[model samples]
Target: MAEQPKGRLVDVELDDTIGRATPDVEHERNVAIFDLIEENVFNPAGAPENGRFKLKLSLVDKRLVFDIRNEADEPLVTHILSLTPFRKVIKDYFMICDSYYEAIRSATPQQIEAIDMGRRGIHNDGSTTLMERLKGKIDVDLDTARRLFTLICVLQWRN
Candidate 1:
């Protein structure tokens, strides 16, 4: 006998029903994460508080998931370089901040002044732009300056 076409062999009536199709329990598990970043190297008004920038890292079913929330009003291009710390959970967020600024904000006299004032007249015994101090001819953008300031602050805070 010729092979019959493979069809539903036992076709009676299979009720393909899924339980809990309409459930409120799913909504209860939903959560919203808020992240905040402040770039306030010039003044304290824009400094971000601890835990303001939230990054969520979780593993689900053998897959890694990352949730990053930045609650900043202005985006990266407008700000160029925002001196925000990064969490391992969120990839490329802070790196973008660093690169975007370094590519755009070159050393300016105003930034030189601000850094000098912030550092308490500690630039080459006078007013020397960040680029001038490096002696490497690298573009000293606002991000680099802010990073130096942050590192200094961290060191001092540790002391």
Candidate 2:
């Protein structure tokens, strides 16, 4: 069946101590939240098409938690995913982001663009992995998955 408009996400937030450290990741967090809320398909498996659902994302015990709720704030279902599958891609993404950041400071524009291309490639890899892992648990489009992956990486940020 075609996805309904009510299947879209309205709100997204972080749950607890998981927070962003770097400025780049902070910007990514804000952008991800904005992009998700503005327009994104996010239908939790078997959940009704309610346009007012909210999501509280978090990490605990090395697991990624998707705390979903209805318009009334009633509990829906919490999907827990093991972080093991995301480690390598996230690490590669971080490394490329670090290179992009440094490139911004000293490298030529062409060099910066090259690093950014690699960064985007790694980001795509992470998003694809996330979509695969979320299979049978939640339904999301590519844009939605990409934004969600960015948030996941944001939660993994540390000093």
Candidate 3:
């Protein structure tokens, strides 16, 4: 059989300068990164399939940076995406998240479920936005995009 695609990540790091996370946000960040490292398809355009890519996420001057490198820390390709496209969705997602948290504390189960549903819908929208932004720069499945989107939001943390 042909070998499986070697387009995968070995490690991922969120730059400290991007900002700190609360305990809960930290948990989500850890889960998202762990899940991403556990399974993903990260094939950056023109990168070799030697299978030793590391990813560093950070924000500089409000721009999102995807610092791709090899196991030896050799630079691969650095994609700095503008936060412009994500501004609205991220804002909406955070607002809905607030509502979801409040609903969990006081609303009925059905109410909580409804808010959570809306939260997931906004999350999906973020994922789609990310996928579109990464188009032609890197290739990732929906699940991968979703995880990355979570990390991105975590970097911009509210809680």
Candidate 4:
């Protein structure tokens, strides 16, 4: 379980904490909590070339839920759920640019699976959901429970 820092979430940013260093590397090194809040960011010029999808980051009780809206105009296009193409592009883009990027880009399937499993563990502890464990079982004071829930919700897993 991640430590519940003694401050508000809105007050913190990765850049402020790590200065000019690569935020992803710093995060990996420190095992920091990461939340990728990819909102519409209002691409009034219009969404991505592949159309728009609602990417919401919100507090559900204390959990930061990644609500991804799946919408596509073409059936021939593979669905975004697999995320393989997205992963490929990210890797290819970084691979062309920097050697350091290799660490992040060339992560083994085992590493990816472990990351996914960690998230699943947090979200699904055996038969009990994370929300249930934090709120109902894990022994803690009322305030700690409230804050811990908030922390867990906001921490997200991403490519």
Best by lDDT: 3
Candidate 4, residues 46-96, lDDT tens digits: the string is 223333433333333333333334343222111112222233333433343
Which runs of model 3 end up more than 4 angstroms from their true locations?
1-6
Better of 1 and 4 by lDDT: 4
The order of the candidates by TM-score, greatest first, is 2, 3, 4, 1
Q: What is the TM-score (0 to 1) of candidate 1?
A: 0.19
**Each model's C-alpha lDDT?**
0.27, 0.86, 0.89, 0.32
Name the candidate, 1 or 4, with the larger TM-score value: 4
lDDT of 2 at 6: 52
| lDDT of candidate model 3 versus the reference | 0.89
lDDT of 3 by residue, 15-121 (tens): 88656667878898999999999989888988886466899998888989999998899998999999999999999988998788788789999999988889999
lDDT of predicted model 4: 0.32
Candidate 2 overall lDDT versus native: 0.86
lDDT of 1 at 80: 15
Model 2, residue pairs in steric clash: none
As a TM-score, model 3 comes out at 0.91
Measured against the true structure, the TM-scores of the candidates, in listed sequence, are 0.19, 0.92, 0.91, 0.20
